[model samples]
Target: MSILLKASDLKTPMSASDLFSRTGPLVFEVGFGDGRYLEHLASANPEWNLVGAEVSLGSVWRAYRRMNRSGIREVRLFKGNARFLVRDVFEEGSLDRVFVNFPDPWPRKKHLKNRLLQVPFFQILSSRLKPGGSLFLTTDHPEYFEFSVQQGQESLCFDVIQGPPPPATLETKYARKWRDQQKPIFHAEFRCHTVIPSAPRPISSIEMQHATLKGSLENVGPFTKQVRRFEGGHAFVMEAYRELDSQGLLFKVISEEQDFRQELLIQAWPKKDGVYVSLQPFGDPMTTKGVREAVLAVTDWLVSQGLELDQTWV
Candidate 1:
């Protein structure tokens, strides 16, 4: 099984043409809520690349599993906001088709800024879309649909139209609701006419880490035993595993490098007692020395805290 690394980890990327090497043209859908429409499209168009962006963890997990089981090899799914992937991972003119379907309306006057059809969003679409690439947008809310159209025209990258696109996409949950209520599912197809604009460059490392960590913390949980990737991978998860008791406050570290092998490295770091430190080396034996050095560097910087550190325990 492929390891689902933290959001901060590396991802496999390819050139715009190579992105759809195994598949066909890369068709991307952002804010793919309840994903029934994505299912219909990917299943129907097996030759095309199907990329989905979903903010909900359960939604992403479900959609990925469903598409994989459907034998849709061209699909790639991300469990994060659309902005992070578009502004960071994708290059200019990388996508063939972009979809924004029934995003959060943010109806309150104070909350309207949170809607997905803001000015910067149109700019991003302009950068990602190919020279004749089409962006398909749909919303049940008339106000948001008009707002999106206004923003697109103001950006001067898209000429908006109301109705079906060249090749119509499928229907989702919100669209079904609109149909039942006799409410029109407002639609538009925007064609990129000229050179795409460049985004404000990628953020700095500090800003980048802050962005990725926000997504990673969504799946954090309590664990004592090591959580390996697919029961055979190197990545280990240690969560809430270092609580110190007043009595026997020994820290145990466990690692799994490969299948059928588990190594346990126990480091007994006790304050007001050098016996435990003498029994075992002060270093965190489970990790490499380089990681050990990093731990020491961080711990050594905390000397000013009210909590005192022993001469040798980390």
Candidate 2:
């Protein structure tokens, strides 16, 4: 059911506050890194309500902890990307300020498309902002800084702010790391026009990730492998890192006899890592042979890749 947008309660919140209560306008911080800047901003401006959005559970927990530790109680935190959630839930003209600081640069040319400051995103943001609301942004990478400034300058309603957002009492992990690396920081601000351009694309189904994993799974894994509980998930999952050598191989498989929910993620920890294996989120479980063949096909492929028969060490 495509329920229309509404602010303050985007998805379920760890902490919820009436974002705009006529008492004070709300401020939103997208990609609120480690929640440090979020706490600083909220504490500094106690009158303006703050809403922090992040995709990582760790960051969400850190933000919650920061709020508790600082004894600051006037903020809301959400755990998801701001793209889809923002449009569907954030009410128009409800925000006074929105901050984006040092998002992933996605350095590869193909990956540059992954940036947040796209035509579609700016369109959605324009609608979310109050008439004169400001969007603040900062970046440490010179290329990204320039890209953001250019993107903001060309955006439909945005006018690149000449100066940086106000300094805060803290720096996020990346901010601190960049500072240590002695990288220069760039800053900019933008405001949407009275009537901004409409969004270029509609909201997409959640099946994107499911499809991504599906495409990768068919071509991933060691032909022969064994299952092991994943690190944080405590179940088979995808993650970073490479293998040491071609001594052994690991395989993770999951079968849930329930609905078509994306409840599984398989991975391999080969003594030798080639390309990272991406596994299907859901596999057909109506027949035992179907499951076994799916498993063996992946394993046989790995065996063909020269994996040691005795991979039990993995």
Candidate 3:
């Protein structure tokens, strides 16, 4: 069976020992495009546990099929942001090595901030690495490579070593394509020399228990779709759904912030004393600052419709 892991499969700030059920060397590959290198590493080193993180579902599926066919039981896949996975899931000083190959360069000057190898990323990577752990990166983009090197040096947690791309990493599709075109490939090995503590995660868990609101449920009509802009982010009521049994109303809320986003369902049910507004348990959405804002947005909308907001516990 495929060892592809969903977000819910992991606990916030998970440990490597818990994940593999044993303690051994652990390696991670960020942006495992096509999974060639990851597969090679897994097959080549059966003693070490391998974890692959990729955002593309198509690439994830392809990698999953390849690993399944090869009976590679040591490999696991995560489909989401690598930063979040590293910062929120992996324990400190847990990773033996990390590989990032051919990440998007985001060549435009205006989009440089979007690049993955910034100073903040280097700090987080350093904290996640073991005492002697190293990060191996290969890219055909010279500017990005140089930028990454500079960032690593500035972080003071790693000693950058410039070298030729590793043989296994060159097996990737992007590496082969770039090599075929005679483009110069840049490689860097950032050896972690010190530990850098990462900041606490903003959202601790994806599952929200409940929220209570003290307000009347009457006259809660005209729940049309609308968007509200707040100080740091925005919330949008994507749609409203009436319960088939006429018990309550479900509002689909989309919350957006600079670094976080989630689509949650907020339920407005009538309680004995007031309306109970809470996140629907079935959506399995992460409780974030934006999500809390979304709940407040719904409550404020209800108040605007004639209900008075006496209290809120979200």
Top candidate when judged by lDDT against the true structure: 3
Residue ranges of candidate 1 with Cα displaced over 4 Å: 1-23, 165-170, 199-241, 244-314
lDDT of 1: 0.54
- Candidate 1 lDDT, 1-314, residue by residue in tens: 12121333322233444444553677888877656667777777777776677877787777767766676656667566676566655667778888888778888899987776666777777777777887888777888888888987887778787885323333577676777888866778777665457753442222110000001111223324343333223323232233345322232333332211222333223334321311123431223222232223222222222223444432
Q: Which has the greatest TM-score?
A: 3
Q: Compose the digit string of candidate 3's lDDT tens values, residues 113-225.
A: 88988888889888888898999999999989999999999988999999998888877989899989999999999999988888436454434434555665555676777
Instruction: Give lDDT per model, in order.
Output: 0.54, 0.55, 0.80
Q: Arrange candidates, best TM-score first.
A: 3, 1, 2
Q: What's each prediction's clash count?
A: 0, 7, 1
Clash pairs (backbone) in predicted model 3? 206-286
**Model 3 lDDT on a 0 to 1 scale:** 0.80
Residues forming the 10-long window of minimal summed lDDT in candidate 3 = 202-211
Q: Who is ahead in lDDT, 1 or 3?
A: 3
**Per-residue error at 222 for model 2, in Å?**
20
**Candidate 1 clashes between residue pairs 3 or more apart in a chain or in different chains:** none
Once superposed on the true structure, which residue ranges of model 2 sit more than 4 Å away at CA? Answer: 1-22, 197-314
